[model samples]
Target: MPLSSPVPRALRHTRAIEVEAFARDDGLWDLDARITDVKVRDVTLASGVRTGGTYLHNLHLRITINRELTIVDAEAASDAVPYPGYCDTIAPAYKKLIGLSLMKGFRLGVKERLSGVLGCTHLSELAQILPTAAIQAYANDVIQTRDGAGHDPLPDKPFQIDKCHALRAEGPAVAVYYPRWVAKAVPG
Candidate 1:
């Protein structure tokens, strides 16, 4: 979305991040995330002044996991980058996420495993997409579990109002899985 202003303007910088989730035929999941940073107008960066439309960052990441949401494989690549040498070398560190689960505290685990010299900050950010993507990839199972066709989806933890307000203990969404927590409240 472009910001609106009374002042005249020209395209400057555009940073786009896209994350996609895929359900594999064998009951696994695949996540692909790409980040593209473009200079829409001449701008000076640490490297040098870049021409408009030049890509400052073209990074790609892929993660594969099982139904349990435990990472099975992970890979990252930098096709275009603002810096050299260091950024391209972090590919090896992403493997450390292979057994990590797509669950609460997953982001902190990713940061701990890949922060500083071990990982590129951007790639580390991409690791956070796994938990949400797992929801998309397993929507059927989630709904079935909530409907009592499978195990309880919420586990022992009560509905959280802070994490996702729609699923709050005070909202109607609780009726779907934790009917005991349902009450009157704005869904959003």
Candidate 2:
């Protein structure tokens, strides 16, 4: 077992979310997200129940997507939770994520599919982070293959030349990757 960190005080509880990227032999990437809510000291629930060193919410979510970031598979499990029955209530609906692509409008899609009464709040929150992590995990190979080099694990796609100050068409990256869109020098 690894050595534990120093103990904390006044820390009634902790909410830890961990996301891990994994490579599979079948050419798909797997992203695992785990959420844990732990209380350091004994606490009383609103129902007059007392518990300590217990998990308020322990959720594990797995998402498998291909190079194009289309969801190939998804599964979720609740090992423990403050209310176990409520935990599984919204899990089944996450399967709707299949065939959905992770792109610019993906966040809204997540909201539509797994928000409010449609899905588990904690699980939905964790699933929201998978798209970015999946892009980082799966796109490195694609970028390297197509560009002949990995450019920060992502290729320049959309900037519209005026999205932000640093990303202006005159920015260094745009000047190199999208020279045609670069802002021309002004004559004094």
The clash numbers for all candidates, in the given order, read 0, 0
lDDT of 1 by residue, 104-158 (tens): 5788889889987778888888777768767765765542334322555455444
TM-score for each predicted model, relative to the true structure: 0.75, 0.72
lDDT by residue (86-120, candidate 2, tens digit) is 66666668887887887657778889988988888
What 10-residue stretch in candidate 2 is worst by lDDT?
145-154
The TM-score of candidate 1 is 0.75
C-alpha lDDT of residue 60 in model 2: 89
Query: Which candidate should be chosen as best, given TM-score against the real structure?
Result: 1
Worst window of 10 by summed lDDT in candidate 1: 142-151
Q: Which regions of candidate 1 fall more than 4 Å away from where they truly are?
A: 1-10, 141-163, 173-188
